[model samples]
Target: MSWLRPQDVVEKALAASTADAQVTYVVESSEANLRWAGNSLTTNGSMRSRQVVVISFVDGGAGMATGTVARTGSPDVAELVAASEQAARDAGPAEDAVPLVAEPPPGAGEWDADAAETSIGVFTDVAPALAEAFGEARGREELLFGYAEHAMATTYLGTSTGLRLRHDQPAGRVELNGKSADMSRSVWAGVGTRDFADVSVADLAGEVARKLAWSRRRVELPAARYETLLPPSAISDLMIYAYWTMEARDADEGRNVYAKAGGGNRVGERLAALPLTLRSDPFAPGLEACPFQVVGGSSGSASVFDNGMATPAVDWISGGVLTNLIRPRAWALNTTAPATAAVDNLLLESPGATATQDEMVAATERGLLLTTLWYIREVDPQTLLLTGLTRDGVFLVEGGEVTGAVNNFRFNESPVDLLGRITEAGRTERTLPREWSDWFTRAAMPTVRVPDFNMSSVSPAS
Candidate 1:
């Protein structure tokens, strides 16, 4: 749907509303997805939907209701609005009431024509090449599996507060999992990008083949502390955990890693010893994200009392010191502190000379090279300790060379601790963390070398 139609529908909904009511209409339209397994395409489809959410404040009580309709179908905007207003009147008074305010949205010229106007033909044209790549790998006696997807979505958000926002996002991903014929070794390699032209099927296949070849011979290593070399993929996952733990309210409440020993939060504490910096910027090249975040909704669901809060470039960590934290609107109002939205994209900067992953490995005298991490779960929020398994590929490096592949091991570490012990920092690149790629796709990470990394135990699964 064009911008004009959604805007018109929103205007109509607002005009039909009574006093003390606010409404937001969000319309999303996109073409997406091609799933493949066992080296063959299995399913493909597209979707377009629009949802109208109403928030009503009657006599200090708040109520919210949402109605959705397919873009191809007729919708009853008036009926939906009435139902929401009635729900509000039936509800009780809210515990915390914060006034809703409108903020300026992105400029009209901010839309990317290439992203907004992407054609389904792009996927159709690429599927054949990907399939052929899979076939070629399978013929060489390797088991290959994964999925490819292309999506272009335009989100239109309009509120009664005179806030009108529109953003068009284009995303593509190619994930491949390859294993040896005997199932003794495996590796994961993929690409995530906003442009279809950047995904090279041949290069993806080659990467898997090369890793699988490296794992042809395996070595057994007992669980022990080793000097570890973490690639960008591994770094991305750890950084994601750090991002989620940046809640200011939780820290101030003394339930988070950022909490201080006595009273208050650790905003200015030196959490790491290295010259590390972490920040989020929606306008960052190759890692753009939505400029606004929706806040104050019901737990685990989109809130009827939602606010399209503008997100600013946040300097979360700088010069090894805790610089900032995420501040929700309600919490900010209660504490009289500044409000900022959590970021969808994360960027980690390494000071001084930047080395490539291969260069980092070459400089390592003895260490473990971790390709990816999986099943990550938080063990302790106070120390930011986490437990997870090294996956895809684990190699033993000796005398500045990868001697042989090693058994996978479970690890216990924290991103904060890792940063504090960083001996060297290497080149940074846009990476897709295996855990949060579905939601947080834009990340710029660097290869890092740590002096002592805890490898807890050997894992049976390869």
Candidate 2:
């Protein structure tokens, strides 16, 4: 649908709202996708939806109800508004109710015409090249599986208070997993980019093939602490966990890793020894994101009921110091602090000489090379300790070269601790984590060398 249609839907929802209630409409429309498996395309699908949410304020209580409609259907705005009003009458008072945004900040309705008009032909044109790459696999024992998705989504937010916001995001991702016949060895390589031209299926296929060849002979090593080299993919995983713990309220409440030792939060403390900087900027080149973050509603600033809260470049860590933490508007107001929103992308930067993954491996006298992490889960919030298994590819380095593929192992480590122990850092590049790629897609991570990385146990899975 064109931009005018989405605006009309929002206007209808607003016109249906009662005097005592505030209505907000959110419309999202996405293009079709293609799914692939076993080296072939499998399914094609598309999704287009719109939802209208009404917030009724009565007797200090606020209640919300959402009504949804598909692309081919009409919305029941009146019924949804009535339901929300009734719910407010039946519920208790809202303790943290704030008025809806009266006026949206400037630049709320910025539009990217190119992104909004992305077509399905982009995926169709690339499918043949991807298939050809897969067919180039050497042996019959090798198998391939993954998906290619092209999506163009527009989010429109309109409030009864006259706040209007809209953003169009175009995204494309290609993931490929290759494995040997016996499932004894495997490798994963993929690309996620807003521009389809950036995704090179040939390079992805070559990397998988190279890694699979390196894993033909397996070597078993007893679990022990060792110096380790982590590629961008593995480092991106650590950064994601670090960002999740940057909530200001959690730290102020004395429950998160950033809680102070005595009193107050650890905002100014030096968290790592290395001069590392982690930041987020919506306008960052090659990693652009929406200019505004969602605010208000039950989920606070994380809500999809966006209120046009402008997102600016935020420095979470600078020069290895704890610099800033994300704060929801409600919590910020209650505590007399500045409101901040969590960012969609993260960038990790280090100074001095930059090296590539291969160069980092060549410099390491003895260490383990981790391709990526899998099934990572938090073990301790205070220390930011995490546990996960190494998968896809793991190797042992001897004499500044990868000697052999090592058995998978479960590792217990913390991003915070890892940064503090960093012996070297290489050049940063946009990378996708094995896990959490769906959410944290944009990251420029570097190869990191850490001493005494804890490998806790062995895993039988490749």
Candidate 3:
């Protein structure tokens, strides 16, 4: 049987919602997914249910009830509706419910691509291939790791003011890992997309193969700030997190480094140098996600932004000056909705003029190339101070060439400071996961060369 459409579900839920009394909003969502992993082709599948109903009673109060199912029957539905109405009543009065925008203009289609159109079996097969490749690599012991997730979710929303909207997202990720000679070090890679066709396990295996081969040599890296190159994958993770942690709430509380005095906020402040422009674009090719707010449930869908806000496509540290801060809905309302707040996902745009890996090395003069970051954590929320270990691969480059794999080092650095020191960037691209979306990032980055990279300390064991 075809699953319940958002509109149909909304109609049924609304029938139950308005039965007893005042009901401001009723929203519901549902999801189903299939995933696979390992050398074995066992398919992993799951189905999830969610609903959240926001109510406003005549007594000037509001309430909400959220759960995996909408209702069992008449009394259950009555109880839920009553509970929601009472909760709204109990919260006392806030603001009059603002009129949500009218339903979006008709669209050609939902993002639900044909399920039969793709298969993750190839992605499933990649794990063993990576393990096999690692096994073949001389002086390297293959350490196999695997992961895959295929997910789908639907949103059905209804508000008393004639607002109705529905949307859903289907997406997934697949990955593998391999280790080296002493097993003290290793390499990692993964692929992800809304459709399984894009998740090539073989390609993932090949990437691990490169890491296995490239990380053969071990050298000691000297402690000092030096020019460094970052691949695209790593670049994506750092930039994305930089935005997530820079919340307006954090800034207001003076927890963010970019916080300003007198509660005016810091939107256009000069934070970083030129060349770092971070923005969010939901329309970017191959990366479009649902532009609806489901509030962590499987029901009703509102416009992607929690409140009446548009998604931002441009973010800036133009010419290396701090430019924008992502603002969430509640914060936006408190601040009168500045354009600096973003509902879209983050994207760090790099110019086309960046040097290629070879060009970056040629211009390096001397530096280090960091493959991946590990155990990254916050030191100071205000300044973006972070501490993490170099992992998977770390190489020393001298006079335009990778000298060899260097023993991983531990360092503390600021995201703001690191981006500011960039002397050169590479042209290549790699897709990395954002902080909100995935377990580990897969960054496609190019070599970068910086001067005076500080190695605050070293690890006896990496």
Candidate 4:
């Protein structure tokens, strides 16, 4: 079906609206899939049978809820409305309760966004290509593994705020893993919705081969500080999570690191030295997302901007300073909320460099080239001191070349500290997968040269 009309039913429910009536409609459909070792492991597809409707009465302080049937089938709108009213009545009067602002009817095409439909064949055909690519490699490894997962969601939302929106999104992931000596080594994770056919198995196999070969030189860099480089994947994860803890509300309550005195939020603070800026453009070619949001404990789509205004581009960071902080619309209206920032998709920007990773290594004079980080944990929220293991590939770079692979190390460092210490950032920013939600984040990061990075402990898992 090109368009599933949940708004029509929502309007029907609204026609019987009373002076105290408040209503919201949300409809969603999703497809989820998983593949492993070039084989299908699980597939799940569902058109949400229950369309969620919530009605609240401000004067009576009563709320109710109900679930609807399938998209084309009869929906129990009345039951949902009654439930909402009952819910509101059940909750005793609250001094803080406010009436919901009524929204007008939506305009044409307000709830539509273009999206490509996907299917099982996407995984079925790509599985063998992945299997064949990894199988062709001749290595001493006992096992080889890989996985790809794709998910698509479509949400339609309408509210009394004269707001209406529909959003469609497709997210996907792919990764390679291999075991040789005695470790469960992992390759890079591919994130984003680039075509499945575009994943080069041969190229992927080569990366696996390099990691397998690095297994031979397992030397440890003794406990101390040294120059280091962080790939995009690690960078993205660090930044995304760091900001999460730095939320204004958390800061306001002394729950976060950047909280300021006198109920003021932190902005225009210089946090890092390495030139970095992050922004979200839903229309950005590779990173567009569904712009609307659902109300808290409510489903479907709310307007993009919190105050019924148009959605604004979000800047998580700019020139190494805290520029934008995400705040809810209500908060924005009452207070100077830093823009309400979610763990939104991040894009890294850097200038074209004069040299390559090889040249950077050659220029390093002496340093550690870290391929990936793992088992990350937070030690201090205030300082952002994070602990994690160096895994799969850790190499020692000397006089512009990888001298040898090094043993894994337990290290503690802050993203702010690391970015500040960067002496040389490669000209090219590479898009890499993040550790959390490995499927969605595409970190535009470059090889950074940092001096005096602390490598705290040694580990056998090289």
Candidate 5:
């Protein structure tokens, strides 16, 4: 693939723009992937791509208007700039318009550095470990299927206001599924990582093996409320959904669950009975993300006018109480609140939580254990009701032991409401959300127990 320095491209675009104000962003990315099925490696490859976007701001006498144009790979700086300016000229004034961010963050000094890259070598450790695990699975007449992916992206942001910044981000994930010889039973295990070094194929394989063994006996039970233990992966899925809807404007307008009865958002209201805290930090260890805003559009939670704005750590929910919401500079100005940029990573934790998932399972007398959740969709906006089906594996725990696997069930619950019902929360750890993996994968969560988790109906899914 043809290559151009992302930082240089950002500067060229900024210089080419004729609008009153302009912001240019370039993302140079590299990726590597490995897939295995039927206890053997099926595919392996690497790829490279770049995203170039130019946002132009114009003041058409009445007010400010913004336009955005994006292209893959190398984009002609002049054409991209002209197209963006034309779009701004054709549009009406924008309500979210604000001054372009001018202050340089800590990483801005590294703007001249080349983009970081990833290659097939990212799987050096993963490949051999997968091979050994596949052999073991084959000897046991089991089938192993899964994929491992790694990516590195360097983002460069430049603005007419004299801000130049760059960030290098690396992300990786691995998922493994084990099925019995006849495909009668299946189980899943997944891990989120910054690199493959910390991942252990043996540990993941062992978890899959144990779950499949528990499925040797099947139990059929009607759908009803039951004490349920949701693992970290499941918890991440629910919490991420809640995080995505944290637009301050939506709640203040009484359009979502965080809205107060009369007016304003529930900034001080407690959503969970336990003193849990849900936060996002760009500098979070092992889950670090870009520390500033880079945008080509405007939304309730963000604005193109605020491109290159510094993103500080924020606690949306602190000590169980709503603490903050995603508020761009424009929205913050409107609401008379401090601007809060949304970070890409999320973490949910509580004080004094130290029990592992196994310990939580061992302490349970009678409850359901969920392996994963899928097909999740929103049912209601006001109450934040979400519906989804359990998949891969669900087990019945009796007398502090897993007795047998149970039938899958469709569940209807609200992440907001579910928080208030949490009876126990285990230690926080990195996890992979099976449902939202395609869009969101950076999360750290804990296993949680709900005494009466609602199983809306019995699902025939296998």
Candidate 6:
């Protein structure tokens, strides 16, 4: 029915399924965006959508099999369920199959609530501030370009095992780019927030202005290993990539970087000397996410059978030691490890790291400050080697201060290996990863100082 709510959609899908087991979920999302270029607003709009996912299980002899079908907007409930069941019968036994999650854990989310939503009104306070920033940029003979977006997705999950769980996740990001009138010098600043309330347009504009001012005197530096300071946004991109590779099965099978030299994963080995802790929490203040598992397809890090499973606080790396990896229940049964679902939000911090990025800059005798990392690609799975390019703003720090902007360079390094060489981690702050923001946006990280960061080559990219 056109009038069906998101919760009704989930309930209808579950009721229509005739398989041995079933799990149904509906994600109702609302998004609002603001885009600007050349110091002028280009467009602003809002949209709403609904997505339905139905997973059906069948017992056709050897073992249980599962199949999933996902559809955008309001789908025909009975037909979708039938499709899922038929898909299950057409496939072979699922290796990751297990009994569905029957009970809710401590933070399984609400059972009855309206779907959270967002509208263009979320940017009510931001528009005027952005206009002011535009005026300031115009007077400075600079151009501003960027986008701001906020979205709220409410998930309604239901299972045949008698569980109904829901979670509302709000994700927002604002990126501001400033360039000189000639477009030769450019810099970027971005922030991540659950709501626009915490984002400060003036502060972001000031940061961009300062970077652009520093770029007035440009210098060329050859590709070489140098002391580097990676800001929180840049660090988040690297750390998030590392976090995505934390699969128990891959490491245990000697397939990835976390694998030990012998035959097992490095679950307890010290990976760094600086006592860094990389963790995820479903309820991390401004970065809160879904408290329970919600997946339409099964993979190395997630399983369709694990729906409604609670995602608690997990310390992937604690005090420089590898603590745990994502282990679904099906894989946990084989490894003798507890099922640890992955949370959507991640944070990396070190105790007593009170220095800000400016403070770290003041302490540096000579180094490079990276604003963003883009075009990242994996080079080697064995050692987690990654290659990417520095973009927008690359500043030269000399004698405990930022002297001027430098040339962009291609970089080669691995987050796992780089962890060991970290000399300092500035205070953790919520920031947006420019490369991975499309997929992973909720992250808090610290500006990290590396003694000898590898700059593979000077890039011609302006």
* Among all candidates shown, the one with the greatest lDDT: 6
From the highest lDDT down, the ranking of the candidates is 6, 5, 2, 1, 4, 3
Off by over 4 Å in 2: 1-4, 19-23, 56-73, 110-119, 139-141, 295-297, 300-306
lDDT of 6 by residue, 1-462 (tens): 585887888888878878999999989899999999999999999999989999999999989999899999877888999999999999899999899999887766676789889999999999999999999999999999999999999888999999989888899999999999999998999998888999899999999999999999899999999999999989899999999999999999999999999899999999987999999998898888888899989999999999999999999999999999999999999999888899998999999989989999999999999999999999999999999999999999999988899999999999999999998998998889899999999999999999999999999987
Better of 1 and 5 by TM-score: 5
lDDT (10s digit) by residue, model 2, range 1-462: 244466666676678766454545454656667677667778877665544445555554344333222232355656665666676666665545455556565445553232265556777557887778667763456777787776666766667667777876666777788888777778888777776778888888888887888788778988899899988889889988988888787788887888887766888888878888889988788787777765335552353333566788888999999898887666777788787777678988887747888888888889899888989999999889999999888988988988889998999998988878887888878887768887778788888888898999998876
Per-residue CA lDDT of candidate 4, range 1-462, in tens?
Answer: 123356666665566455254545554444445545422233434333335555555454243222222223454666656666666666555322333444432222355453345566566666566656555542354345656666555555555655555656666666666556355444443434544654565666667666666556656568888888766666666666675565555565554566665656567877667566666655556665545444433211121223122344576678777786656544445555533635335665555555566677777778787766777899987667899887667777767767667777888888766656766777544354545655454445566677887889887764
Compared to the true structure, candidate 2 yields what TM-score? 0.90
**True lDDT of residue 365, candidate 3:** 67
lDDT of 2: 0.74
* Per-model TM-score on C-alpha atoms: 0.88, 0.90, 0.76, 0.79, 0.98, 0.99
Candidate 5 vs candidate 6: the lDDT winner is 6
Model 5 bad stretches (over 4 Å): 1-3, 107-109
Q: For candidate 3, lDDT tens digit of each residue in 11-42?
A: 55557664223222222322333333323334
lDDT of 6: 0.93
Question: Any runs in candidate 4 off by more than 4 Å, and if so which?
Answer: 1-27, 32-34, 38-81, 84-116, 139-142, 181-189, 252-254, 261-263, 297-310, 337-343, 352-359, 427-432, 438-442, 460-462
Question: Per-residue alpha-carbon lDDT of model 5 for 110-193, expressed as tens digits?
Answer: 878878999999888888999999988988889999999999988988899998888898989999999999998989999988
Report lDDT (Cα) of residue 284, candidate 5. Answer: 90
Model 1 lDDT tens row, 1-462 = 233455566677678878475645444456567777666777876665545454555554244332222223336767756766676666666533455557674532232222264545667656888778778877988877787766666655566777766776677777888887777788999777787677777877888888887787789999999999988778889988988888877788898888888967898888677778899987888777777754324431123344566677888999878898887666777667777677678988877747988888888889999889989999999989999999999998998888889999999999987888987888778777777788777788888888899999999868
Order of candidate numbers by TM-score, starting with the best: 6, 5, 2, 1, 4, 3
Candidate 5 yields a Cα-based lDDT of 0.91
Query: 1 or 5: which has the higher lDDT?
Result: 5
Global lDDT scores for all candidate models: 0.74, 0.74, 0.53, 0.57, 0.91, 0.93
Q: After superposition, how far is residue 409 of candidate 1 from its true place, in Å?
A: 1.9
Colliding pairs, model 5? none
Regions more than 4 Å wrong, model 3:
1-6, 18-79, 92-143, 249-253, 261-263, 296-312, 316-321, 328-341, 428-430, 434-448
